[model samples]
Target: MQQMQVYARVITQLIASEDHTVQDLNSAISAVLRLNNINKSESPQHLKRVAHYSRLIATNCADTYSLSEEWIEHLYLFAPLHDIGKVFLPEKLLTKPGPLSPQEFERMKTHTLKGRDIIDHMIDSFGYKDHLHYTGMLRNIVTHHHETIDGKGYPYGLKGDEIPLEARIVAVADILDAMLTKRVYKEAWSMDKTLKELQKLSGSKLEPEFIGILASHKQELMNIRTASAE
Candidate 1:
């Protein structure tokens, strides 16, 4: 218990500080999650890659949309936590080799709210008043990352501008990574196929503007994917 408290303190400090490097903070968070055996099937490197892609998408969207640099930085830092909800999923579901049963799928979907609950609990316990902006944004992003632009997404079926831009950016990054990365139940799709699919989803499943940014920077995004693999 004492050791756990010490570690929690360190994590809280790292997250709250503006000057802490994102790489260091992410490393610490991943370490804790790994120690808890939450990521039994997925490689830690996969999460790192997703983080990279999400940040890239966020940065690109920020530039294209004329968002403040500070806002973009916050989005980049909080984007990884979008899937931190997966930590709440049972290892069996997370590592399952076959497609999930409807019941299992429903259970898996709760990770979004579960992640929000976890962050909310942390804020309540730690009294992280000032970090509210970052934490609040992250919580929303985590809960809504799976949501689509056309109201097909789960949890809340927000459409178009109804979804926050941060969530919209993450939705694109998340889908891209999921499609390109090999998984237990399916083989990886080619980048061309993945981009084509994303294009198909534009205006309906994804924001057209965000998709445009992704389309324009296809090579850079691929480089992030390749570099993270090594």
Candidate 2:
């Protein structure tokens, strides 16, 4: 524990003052996860695109939420960490070619809690001690990205403004990225189909304001998708 504390302090000292340093930190953690095969089933580009998409959405919608520039920067940096807890999940479940059974779905939901717990452990162990101003934003993104505006989402049934604005932005980014990315269970969805699905989910499963924002930005979204694929 003492050695770990020393390691944590060094990391904190090095990156504590700059938000951009968190990008390096995030990438290093992602590399570690990849080396250990924790992210083998996931695309390396998926996280990057989510970060990009979250920034795009949040940047465009900042005025609506009165979001600060710092907050949006944090959203871009930490959006990729939303699924970090999937490291604890069995790879078999992540790569399953069919829909998860009821029991499996329950296990899947636990990732939200697990993600929050993992961050809590890091903060405590690394002696970060709240000096990390954006830790709260990171935690919200990790723990609540799956939550819905209609009180049906898990980890917490938070609705409307009850959900952190950061989480809502990341949630939109995540859903859109997942739709366009191919997986064992589903083919990549076309831009038109994905937008229609987002329309279907608007206000019910996703934040209505964000859906409205994306509705007008179809061409820009296609550009993002094209860039990510290249």
The prediction achieving the highest lDDT against the true structure is 2
Q: After superposition, how far is residue 144 of candidate 1 from its true place, in Å?
A: 0.7
Task: Kindly list the per-residue Cα lDDT of model 1 for residues 14-98, writing each as its tens digit.
Answer: 5787876878877876776775445675566666766677677777666567888777778877776676667656788888989
How many collisions between residues are there in candidate 1?
0
What clash count does candidate 2 reach? 0
Distance from true location, Cα of 55 in model 2, Å: 0.8
What TM-score against the true fold does each predicted structure earn?
A: 0.88, 0.89
Q: After superposing candidate 1, which stretches have Cα over 4 Å from the reference?
A: 1-11, 131-133
Q: What is the lDDT of residue 53 in candidate 2?
A: 85
- Per-residue lDDT over 95-184 for candidate 2, one digit per residue giving the tens place of the 0 to 100 score: 889999999999989988877776766688766766777888877988999999998898889998899888998899889988988888
Clashes of each: 0, 0
Residue pairs in candidate 1 whose N, alpha carbon or C atoms collide under 3 angstroms:
none
